[model samples]
Target chain A: MAHIVFEQVTKQYDNGFVAVKDLNLEIGDDEFLVLVGPSGCGKTTSLRMLAGLESISRGSLYIDGQRVNEKSPRERDIAMVFQSYALYPHMSVFENMAFGLQLQGTAKPEIQQRVQAAAAQLGIEELLDRKPKQLSGGQRQRVAVGRAIVRDPSAFLMDEPLSNLDAKLRVQARAELTKLHKKLGTTFIYVTHDQVEAMTMGSRIAVMNQGILQQVDTPQNLYEHPNNMFVAGFMGSPAMNFFEATLTQTGEQMVIDAGALQLPVPEEVRSRYQSLLGTPLIFGIRPENIYNPEFAPPGINPVAIEATVSVVEMMGHEEIVYFALGDGHEFLARVDPRSRFTPGESVSVSFDMNRFHLFDKASEHVLVS
Target chain B: MQDASNIMRLLGAIAAIIVGSGGIIALFYVANLVVNRLPPRPRSQILPWVYMVPALVMLGAFLVLPTLRTILLSFMDRRSQGWVGLDNYIFAFTNADMLIAFRNNVLWLVLVTGVSVGLGLVIAVLVDRVKYEPLAKALIFLPMAISFVGASVIWRFMYAYQPPGTDQIGLLNAIAVALGYEPIGWLVNKSVNNFALIAIMIWLQTGFAMVLLSSAVKGIPKDVIEAARIDGASEFQIFWRITIPMISSTIVVVSTTIIVLVLKVFDIVFVMTGGNLDTDVIASRMIKEMFNFRNFGRGSAIAVVLLLAVIPVMVTNIRRFQQQEANR
Candidate 1:
């Protein structure tokens, strides 16, 4: 087991295109740290670098407090599972799992025993003799994991290992991977572009964008308190909506001038910016934080605003109502299924002021991180 | 009576070849059985090499030992007694007749090997996804089925020349006359005769190259290529480190095949040009020295040079094949 640390690690291609930049992350031993981003966001590059597969263009990487910039993948004692599984086409499943051990010069009988043990753990003992082409996507994925497990390496690096499987199989594999991580008790640096996978599997998720590290935090922390406009917009489905407005401090109330609507800021947030008035700022609120005014529970003071319902999607348990604000800016509100809302109808919505995010217009950094 | 005697000679030659080949194979099989019967029972991998003993032995007897003897004999006089030093080699390099043969062989090697492999690669890539590829490949490959002598005879008729006027009997001169040009002797022109000879070689070897390279290209998987890069391989490293190793056996097979074939090629040049008018290759020159001029020293000297040239390429090919098999 190893604790991996990336101290300002960066990956830059020969053409001066930086895939990752100034990434400082510490993954503790036995911790599952996921690197998540969209395509071309350097998640896989970071993972491959950790696996000693890509050279660090700048900065240093440490595994268990030992600098390993010059170490090869074999010397690093790490096992990797590629997105396609990358099983040697000529080898049987058993041979595929035994290849690393054989390369390491592990004894023949021991290689077979470890391979069989891994295969049995994966419920693929009968598949040992079959080639990768004969197996289904999930089966191939398990073989890839088994190949890593058989190595008993210091860490396991997986690059979107479940992406090839179908939706149902992906869910099943995701659960199995989490269980595997716990059982092995080895550090796993998983890379994927799926936010759901990062949130569900990673004990800590590191969000990245355009070669820059955005945030490294727990899923609940990322959802509740985002650090910037990008993080606030990227964390949740339906995305957080942003509107340009100016904060104005009146005698006792801080009212937001949102073009055609005026909403009061909660007193606690108002006190933080009482001295600064008439400054333009970006207001962000998650879809779930806004509710149908009629169904919004009584007890706390709510900021009421009017909007024209554009579309209503019934999602079994809740209805996501897309609405256009008076100034033509659009956003969504997740309302109770019992609420009666339809397209082309104007409805009053209440923003949960306590749950909204505020950001500076110029810097785009969250004002309340 | 002469015909009966000739038939008997022919039968004897055929029988000798059959018995020689069968005896070598049986000898290797018995050796393999003996090795299998020995103690310390876990060396099964020696079995393949044991099976390889027949080919190795044949190569040693007919090719390697003869090459070594020729190199040794190249330093001696025709009687194989006096030390001639580099006399035969000097005659080979400086003599105008031998120089012409040397230049012609160079032309044949460059044109035949280069063009055959280049054109074969192009054709293989083009027909890779075509619907009637196998039919096209088979049709193109038909030349290989005909012996080089047979092909030379066929193309000889195609290039058959006649006198300027009286009925151009040859197909080429007939076409020339039809196209309103004077009849021309195709093989008599020193400037173009080498090319004409080289064309027959390229035609016969291109199909072999195409079949081997095509299969090698198809065997490479995209996943393995990407995995190679992900496993710390750069572009050139990926090419040399993974791609080459994967397809190396095919490359060595095709290249050595063409190289060895070209080194000893004589049937086409002998049949078509009779090794005259700048069309004489090393093989033809060697035969002319040994059989026609009765200069065994010169012929063996040329044979030694050819063998030496081919040995390096064969050694490199053997090493690559060994590496590939080891990885497997």
Candidate 2:
């Protein structure tokens, strides 16, 4: 119901620690924008500032085009689910859900009806009279959510709401929250350190590091094209592998020379590297993009290289093979499980040249042609 | 012969010490042995009570027997030689001095309990947010370490009075003289004397209430308060709706404790004014009746009244504790 904007939002504590540095994010109405980062990355601080729980030190915040920097949380009409659930332990589940309505002076019957509706929506109708201490963790989590939804606020700000649940329940709750967001169609600004939750639930994930907003993009876009070394390494499991290499012109071809192995640039992209010849660069490739020569995918601009297998992890779907070059540069490859490979075996592997990435060695920014 | 008799006395004293302690152990050991030989079902049923025998016997002899004797003596004459029926009870309820004591006791109960707990809770909430919280709390709680008699003695000097023409030595009279007002006798003025005594008791009991209530307030989770704020509760609303209800159990505990203490308030009245000038309370009057007047039946009747007054408060406390246990 509200489109929240953070214009140069910065959170500087009294101890001189800047938690969030000039973060500017635009969350559209009904958008599920997740602020994701590692711990101490200021994601929760950002959400709290939006919820009016924390004061914005140096920025203007707007909800539906109206500046709300000075407004209290009640005036902002935002409901929040805390990481600890924060349900009133003394109140029964029904009373917990009815509290906000009662405070707003909503009629008693309407309060009861709305609470009942939210409880039914959460499939927690039987738990109305039970206190928070009497419920299981999952039930308490639902009650927290139900308490927020009963108020029907402009937006719902959840700070890692599912983190307390067990892994299986967390996954189930993740899907339920996504469905709830869609059903409610209210803007949700969720804060979590979990990459999987951000990738799965967020319409757009804003990745942050060291109080700086690194990138804000869709999950697929972030996976396919990260802006810098941190994003590239942080996005995928087992991470993308990097090699310190130099782009050298070997007559008609530009070959990346890393001393251990040399990879010839495919002719289609060779012209883009001609001007950068004799310059140092960092070459990167995803684990899934590397393959055993015998199981290499067709239509790839393949460049063959040789290495020794240092370790083999036999995952049922695929094997994660660790390879070491002659110069002792090691990298992981996700290859076909059926490929016969073992530790200490010399093998030929093919790199999908079309999928490789190059970055400036000094700046670490991805090179674009 | 004197040396020999001294050695014998020493030997007898050591033997008595050992025998007394050993006798208690042997009694419990023999009881456990006897219970063990019974059928398993009956043994299980009777084992706990067997262990409780010493305590129960002591309670019966010291508590139950005295209470029964007091009740019995209440219905007899001054010498406890003939039945007087309701004469002593009527005197307890209708006598002019006893009436003043009852009124004073009620005033103490309401004002002392109300002000101490209310002030304690308010101070607790305020200090919780201050930077020097521990220091402030320690200072506020220091008075609780003083016994009721000691606190009353301290306040006696505080409320000390002198004639207007004389140099004022008491803190209150000194302040009044500095302000150019005539020095007033705080404990002798019948209209305000009970209030003066009650203030001293409040000064002593407030600290006890504050310490307990402060801990209860600290036990409330921080995030819960934050959630309430986000749920549209103002600072005042949060205190009333969230804080008060959250620490209500502790409030009940502190209230009943202060109430019981107030009901048996004697030391302040006794030490400050000796129940003169309309400062008499139930406990102080009971003491005077039993020891000074030496009226056995009337004293017993007043003692029974004080016990009856305290029973309801104790019952409520027990019921609350039981409910808490059942919830757990």
DockQ list for all candidates:
0.12, 0.68
TM-score for all predictions? 0.61, 0.87
The candidate maximizing TM-score is 2
Chain B TM-score of all predictions, in order?
0.76, 0.92
Distance from true location, Cα of B211 in model 1, Å: 11
Clash pairs for candidate 2: none
Choose the strongest candidate by lDDT: 2
**Total clashes in model 1, counting residue pairs 3 or more apart in sequence or in different chains:** 0
Could you say which candidate leads in DockQ?
Answer: 2
List candidate 1 segments past 4 Å from native.
A297-301, B1-328
Q: Per-residue lDDT for A1-369 in model 1, tens only?
A: 998899999999999999999889999999998888889888888988887778999999999899999887666878888898987666688977876776667899999899999999999999999988799988999998898899898898989998989999999899999999999999998999888899899999899988889999988898788899988888788789888888887789888777876878877777787654777788888898888877787765678888999999999799999999878889988899998688999878888887777788898988864
Tens digit per residue, CA lDDT, model 2, A127-194: 99999999999999999999999999999999999999999999999999999999999999899988
The C-alpha stretches of model 2 lying farther than 4 A from their native spots are: A243-249, A252-262, A274-282, A292-296, A302-330, A333-350, A360-363, B1-87, B176-182, B325-328
lDDT score for candidate 2 against the true structure: 0.91
Per-residue lDDT over B153-255 for candidate 1, one digit per residue giving the tens place of the 0 to 100 score: 8888888888887887778889999999987788898777788788888999898888877788678876565454433445555455455556657766787
Interface RMSD of each: 4.1, 0.7
